[model samples]
Target: MMKTALHSVSYAGVWPGQARLGLDDFLERTRNLGFDAVMLMAKRPHLSLLDYDADARSRLRQRLAGLGLKVACLAGYTDFCLGAERPDIPTRELQILYVRELARLARDLDCGLVRVFTGFDYANVSLDQQWGWCVTSLRECARQAADAGVNIGIQNHHDAAVHYESLFELVEEINEPNCKIMFDAWSHAPVEKAASAGFRQEGGDLVAAVKKLAPYLVHTTVADYVHRPRYRYQPNLINYICESDALRAVPLGEGFIDYKSFFKALKEIGFDGYVAYEMCSYLRGGGSEENLDGYARKFLDYLSAF
Candidate 1:
């Protein structure tokens, strides 16, 4: 059975000009929304290591117990090769330490997973070198998490392992029992550039990607979005032309993504982990507490039906 979870980023108001709800409020809101668990943003205004000490962790655990909520995972923001821009920066070490501390907190909170990311590509570094850095750093992170009895999920949200094959290679390279893919339909969608990265031989085939990567999937974060074509006006030419597609978040099953196929694949593969919902970006309805709660419930109902 797949458990439903809500990411607190939906309520953190991290985006500018959005409603700011504290973590405690977010927890209570999630419980009211009827989720099985929650995936907390492991940063400020939430569960930052600097803010969460031993006593704080204890208090948080008690609060969750009272609310009947479980910490599904901790979302750790990291860019392993970000320091490549300036050799003096110890970004790799800092990120590793960050994950280590999150792992400790996960243990204290009785959570089993911490979600992490690879680095974006840097102009100053070769792609392969960036890949090597991520592999090495992720190995250390996996070791640290394993020591704390927590699992680390590598989300395909960064350039280093954005493609399905690249992400699979990353898992094989790390070869840690605790390291697994937090796969989602968005990244697995084969687009024009997927050939070079090996997402799928055929493009725009998300179901294939899900089926292919099913064995290594431990968690998945989901949100739906509609693509509005971006048009630019050339006043001199008196013509408007399409530039790109502006993705706007919508209630589940209302976007361009074929989530039915994606979820179907997960079910076919017997994926029994958390299916997390998030509104981490600009939402269709403005970010009000009522709107956020409404969207979260929409997602909950969608997952229940799915």
Candidate 2:
């Protein structure tokens, strides 16, 4: 059966006016919210490597067991092509080490997955060079993570290989057994619609994308968003200039994402992994604890249909 997970980022204070929650409080809130699992943000104000020691890991593992909550995955932030111009900075090596340590932490916490991201496209960096950096770094990360019985999930959040087709090719190039895809509808739905239509469209071929990545898919993060059009006043021209639409987060099933079709495709592929809900952006309602909890509860209600 597919499980539901709440990402700690919902309470990480990354978005404007969102209140911060400590790790312990986040875990308790997740359990109280009726989620099957929790995705911990592996950074400051959550589960930073510098803050968690051997003893802390043990205590956390026990706490999860007590709450009947499982650690779905550890969110790791990385950009392999960050310092492409400055080769001496060793950015790639440092990221590899970070993933390696995250793998160790996952093992200690009894979690089996760590979510990572591909590199962003640098201004002066060639596509081939950036792809090579991600491939090399991921291969090493997968190799080390396997030793701890952890899998590395590459999320489709970065510029490089953001498309499902290119992301599939990138993963094949990495060619690691433990390296898998953490595909999501947020990025692809917009891209697919833009590529197909001359302008931005409402929905995309979520079914096809999910089917394509189903085999390698281990986890997925879900969020709903609505497009709010923006325009700049052109007083001289007596008109307004249309700008790109701004996406605003909303309660599940309230946005333009074709999640019904998306989830149907996952069921067809027999995807039984954790489906995580993340409030990583400015939400429709104000960032109060009551509003956050209400949004999270709505996600569970949304998933119950399928």
Candidate 3:
């Protein structure tokens, strides 16, 4: 059966006005919210490598066991192309080391997955070089994670492999058994919307895209969004210049995303994996404890149907 997990980013205070909860408190809240598992942000104010030592990991594992909450995955932030312009900085190596430590931490926490990202495109570097960096770095991360019995789940959040097809190709090129895809619907919803408006793009159909990636998908994150239009007033011409619509996060089942098709596809594939809910941006309602908890509960209610 599919399971529901809450991501700590929602309450990590990373976003403006979002309530920040300590790691322990977040875990307790997850249990209180009735989520089957929890996805840790794996950084400061939560599970920072510097803050969590060997003893800390032990205590955290025990706490989760006590709460009957499973660790779904550790969210690892990485950008392989971040310092491509300044190769002297060893950014790729540092990120690899960061992921390595995360793998060790995941092992210590008794978690089997560590979610990562490919790099964003840099102005000075060619896409080929950035792709190579991501592939090489992810391959190494996967090799190391394998030793710890952890898998590296590459999320389609960054520039590299942002498209589902490219993401699939990237994973295939990485060629690591332990490396898998952490697919999400919000990432593809925009593309599908664009495709409907005569924009050419792959994976425009959410169901087909999900089926295409179902074999490699090990984890997925759920979030809903609605586009808010923006325009720049051109006083000189007495007209307004249209700009891209700003996406605002909203409660599940309330946004423009077609979660019915997305979840239906996942069900068709028998994706019995973690479907994590994350509030990673400024939300529709204020980010108070009451609103956040209400959103979280609504997500559970939304998933109960599937």
Using TM-score, give the best candidate's number: 3
- lDDT of model 1 at position 211: 77
**Could you give the C-alpha RMSD of every candidate to the true structure, in order shown?**
2.5, 1.9, 1.1
Model 1, position 62: C-alpha lDDT score: 99
lDDT per model vs. reference: 0.86, 0.91, 0.91
TM-score order of candidates, top first: 3, 2, 1
Off by over 4 Å in 2: 199-204
RMSD in angstroms, candidate 3? 1.1
TM-score of each: 0.94, 0.96, 0.97
Off by over 4 Å in 1: 190-204
Model 2 scores worst on lDDT over the 10 consecutive residues at: 195-204
C-alpha RMSD between model 2 and the true structure: 1.9
TM-score of predicted model 2? Answer: 0.96
Point out the higher-scoring one by lDDT: 1 or 2: 2
